[model samples]
Structures are given as structure tokens and as C-alpha cells.
Target: MLGIKTVFTEMLGIDYPIIGAPMFLVSYEELAVAVSRAGGLGTIPLPNYRTLADLKKALESIRKATDKPIGVNIHLSGKFPWKEQLALCLDYGVRFFLTALGDPRLIANEVHACGGKVFAGVVSLEQGLRARNCGVDGLVAVGAGGGGHCGSIPALILVPYLKEKVGLPVIAAGGISTGAQMAAAIAVGACAVIVGTRLIATSEARAAQAYKDAVIAAGPEDIVVTDRITGNPASWLAKSIEKVEKQPQLGSKRWLDIWSAGQSVAQVGEIKPAGEIIKDMAREYSEVCRCLKNTLVP
Candidate 1:
């Protein structure tokens, strides 16, 4: 197996500098476990569980499936009982957390107290600096073309910009789906890459079969960034956008059928097991490195 090392892998005790980027309805125990078992970090979004018991059960299930490092994703701005969710996850021995949408100061302190790490999602240099000031261990740079709420900067620029400005280990997210893309991100100083839209096409993801098919069918042109669904600018399949535009009555339930995906959807051709996805990515990354060396040296 080809193993790639970075600050992320060392900090999270994983084999590859990759994370199964946490998705709202898509990421769960099965997906997380599969990614973790395949040598990358896996994370379950806290909002996926309605109650603490459900979250606990999911955590327990993941623990039984693999001893590899797993993380919990918390939407810090959500209305859910995040404080209690954080406490429960900590009690269950979770050492890694991914936070987004709000101040991470409190969460960072709590997690750090237990010798855990908290990586917050940031779309700009300002957000990155705020997260750093809030005591986060690292940043997940959500750049343009990312599936969910993302920023205007492209990963190629955002990764290096954040790396230069923030001085925290940055996990590049957005516009990345293949091993070559992963290598590009690392080459630009990203400590890791987060696989979201590509992972949704994986068999282990909890997304509906229709949603997976939609993702495979989508091209970069088929993706559109809009704030209609979540009140935050997020990329979605154009077909989904059309559906929502026509029905208008789905309201809160719109997200259930209105799928979110990044521009990387163009690269996803088929559904495979999550572990296979990770392994393939790692192999591709290695091959890309080899090719780069061969082509550039001569």
C-alpha cells in the first residue's frame, strides 16, 4: 500500500492525509468506519443524529467496527444541542472534532482539555485567523466548488493562501476528487484533502441511490452555487435546483431531495465501496507523484 504522510495524518494518527469530509445527511457510522478502516480519517456529522442516544449508538457502532481514528462534525451555529452533543462525544472518548459555522473557542478549549484536536472549517483568511485565535488545532479550508457552504476562493489559491497566512495545518476541501488533485493540494502546502462529493458516490455513504446516481450524472456545468436552500451559498446539482424552483412548497424538506454536490461530481463515474475509494485515491496519489517526478526532472 502506498502511504502518504502529512501533519494531518500525524496529528490524527491516520495513515493517509485524507478525511472523508463530513456531509449532513450523507456521512454516518458506516461511511466513517469504512474510510477509517481504509487508512483515512472518517467523521460523522453531529446533526445527522436527532438525539444524544442516537449519536451515542452511532459512535459505539463505529468503535466496534474499527479502532482507527474517527471524528465528529459539529455545526456550531445549528440549533441542535451541540453543547450536550460535544459532552457526550467527549465522554465516549472521541479525540477529534470538525466544527463549522460558529465560534470554536469553547469547543476548542473543551476538546483540548481532554488532549483532543478540533479542526474548524473556514472559507477565508479572516475566518481562518478567527479559528486560530479561538484555539482550533487546524483548519478545513472550504474553498470554491465545495459541495456545502463554501467560499469564493479556489482551493489552488485558498490552500496556499491559508497555509501562508494562518500558519495552521490546512485540510484542503473543494474541487478535489482524484488522486492527482489530492497531490496538487499537498503540493500547494495543504496538510490534507477532504473528500466530500466524491465520497457521496461511495457505496458506504448513506445517501439515497437516486442521489448517488444524480451525482454520477452531474458535470461541472451541472453544478450551481446558490443560497436558496440553506441560506448559505452552497453548490447543488442544477437538476435539484430546478426541482426546488418548480415546487417551492417543499420548504424545509427541500434539502431531502435537493442534492448538494461539488464541481468534482464531474469526476465521479460510479459507485464503489468507501474503502475502495480511499485505496484508489492513495494509489492514484502515488502514481501521480511518480509521474510528476519523471516528467519534471527530465
Candidate 2:
């Protein structure tokens, strides 16, 4: 179990606490199933399918691909039809639900009733606390370098703040790509690290090779934040974003125009299978712990 601290593993019904962050379009049932089967929690983005029938088919595909428990990522901005989407998730026997972009309290009860644990996404101390009050099992604090709709705070800062402000398990997000970074997050009170970009570059992802190519070509500086497209400051490839943000920026509602990626793009350099990435992260994490422990008998 890579990065599997007991806190998150038990809550999500997985061997590892490492969660594949919900990426729009890029994260599909195949990707999710791969991660879960590889020992980490895999997440299926709910809106990708668009309709109940499509969602049902996606869920069935996930089941056929892997027996590992999986989660469904829900957007609460009142954009996607969550009612229709959620019913499908329940029918699929999902054990976890991760709510993003809005209040998750209202969604928690439903998930819980279906025997699922809820991991509500939050960008601030206040939002995390609110979700905690709503009985969410955990909080995924998406930070400064996290893909779309990122937070103003840095993950290094957000993890600790969330641990203090809320009683639930805290999963840190942002530019976390290596075990050392994952170790740092855990040392700072994070139960697990939510990895996005690293997984994006993985072979199992549904993104175009060009997208992965862009991530490899980019450095941290290459990722620019522009509300010029999303209204909310989102970090993405500057070259691609420049063109998208310039179209009079008719709001981010036009998701097709802009793409999303986190700053970890600078740290990652190649594309491998999502399961391979998960396996490697887990292996590295264990090595990191072992290397650290070799130092002493205090």
C-alpha cells in the first residue's frame, strides 16, 4: 500500500491513501479502475458521461476492469445534473464520493446512506470546516498548484491549516509529485496526497498525447494563472491558455476552450501507465520511509 496511512485507507476502502484526483475529460472509468486496481483509490468523474445511460455504461466498464472500490467525483456548481448522476453512482455500488466546487454537506447524507464515504473538496479553512460539520469523512484540500479552480493557498500551507480547522482526515493536493513531497505533506499533518498532474501524464489517462507533451515541455514558470478564462484563477499551460483566454473569455463555462493542469508539470517528465505511476509512487514512498528509518535508534 503506497501512501496508505490508516486514516485514509480505512475511510476510502482502499489499500493506499493515494487518490487519483478527478480530472475532467482526462479521468475516465478506465483510469479510475486502473488506479484502484493498482492499490490506490481511483476516481470516476461523474459529468464525463453526460447522461444516466452513459454514466451507467461507464460504471459497468469500471467494474469489469477492476474489482477495487472506486469513487465518483461530483461537481456541485449546479451545472451538471447531480440528481440524475448521483442516482447512477448509488446504483453502481460506489463506496466513495468526492464532491468538488461547492458545498458537499447536502451531498454527504446521500452518499452515506448508500454506504459510501464522502471526501469533500475545499479550497479554504472555512470551506473545509463547513464540510466537516456536514459529516464528510474527509477533506481534499486543492491548493495553489492544483489543476482547475485552484485555491489561493499553497498546499504546504493548506494541509496544516486544514488539519487544525477540521477533525476529518485531510488529503493534500497541488504540486505533489514525489514521495519526498508526499512525506512532507504527511509530516505536516496530511493523511494522504491527492496527485493530479503526475497522473495526467500517465499512459492510462484519456488525454491526447499532445496534452501530455505539453506537460512534459512545461516548467513551473510555463504554467500561468489566468481568470481571463475561468473567472477563478486556474493554472494551465501558458501557450495553450493564451489563445483560449483571448477569445473575449466568455467565462470558463466553455471548458473546451481551456485545459487544466497543476504546477507539478515541472517535476514530471514522462508518460507511463496510471497504474505504473501509482506503483512507482508507492514503491518510492516505502523506500523513502526505509531510508529515513535507517538513520537511527534514538
Q: Model 2: per-residue lDDT, tens digit, 154-208?
A: 9889988888878777889898888777877887888888888888888788888
Would you give me the overall lDDT of model 1?
0.89
- For model 1, residues 1-298, the per-residue Cα lDDT tens digits are 5679888888878999888988999999999999999999998889899888999899888888988888888878768788999998888778889887688886887888888999888898998998899988988889999898878999989989988999989989998888999999999999999999999998889999999999999899999998977798999888987887799788878869889999999899999999998889999999999988898754
Specify the highest-TM-score model's number. Answer: 1
Question: What's model 1's lDDT at 69?
Answer: 85
Off by over 4 Å in 2: 1-3, 244-257, 296-298
- Candidate lDDT (C-alpha), each: 0.89, 0.81
Relative to the true structure, candidate 2 reaches a TM of 0.91
